[model samples]
Target: MKMSDKKEILNSDKAPEPVGLYPHARRVGNLLFLSGVGPRKRGSKEIPGVTLDHLGNIAAYDIEAQCHSVFENVRHVLEASGSSWDKLVDVTVFLTNMQDDFKTYNEVYARYFKDNQPCRTTVEVNALPTPIAIELKCIAVVDG
Candidate 1:
């Protein structure tokens, strides 16, 4: 592919920095692919709804709060790429305790996507890069 056709990184000061080397999202053609977004706030170590021990182990958490933050962060990345929640086509959700958290997470998710609901998949994972209980990775279709 031509260099101009290569993917472009997307970043937003309103969103938390990536936990690793990857960008917040990448644009390839008309699609924007977002990285996993956690509940940690921008420029801070705070993870909403999560209480961490001295050693950074999760002591307790509120799935509703974390879910809100994660979805808002995803929105920031999407807007940074000139897209919006309505443009989202698919989303992959990761939960540390799916059996216990799915109901609450789904409730919050429904509030956000009341009209433009996208295809979604929720999976249970042992853990994430941070102590937060939830993360979201999404894909959006953007107009040229």
Candidate 2:
């Protein structure tokens, strides 16, 4: 088989537009690598649960809302790339404020990953590209 057949870039119209120049996920062999995905709504710049100040700073945010939306965004990318929520093998979560958000995020996460629990790592970061509070990087298995 040609080398090209082993690697494919996958983009989902239903997912939020990537903040950088990257596909939503890249398929390599039987695995899919998802770029860091935020909770921005598709076809718009609005970030769920984020209320910005006049100068574009995070005034207040809801971790629950962002968590739910980001999960949905990941699901869209996974399904579009020939995978499913149950196939997710690993996930990396980045939060702007761990002390303030981790509990809420984890609670929301448990509801979503209750059945297909994937290996997960959550860390606090200085900030993400946008005003959103959370972002997720994920990996999944893609079966032929």
RMSD of each: 1.7, 1.4
**lDDT string, candidate 2, 12-85, tens digits:** 99999987899999998898999999999999989899898999888988999999999999999999999999
Candidate 1: residue pairs that collide: none
**How many backbone clashes are present in model 1?**
0
lDDT per residue for candidate 1 within 46-128, as digits (tens), equals 99998888888888999999999998899899998899999999999999998899999989999999999899999999989
Any idea how many clashes model 2 has? Answer: 0
Candidate lDDT scores, in order, read 0.90, 0.94
Give the candidate number with the greatest TM-score: 2
For model 2, how big is the CA root-mean-square deviation? 1.4
Clashes of each: 0, 0
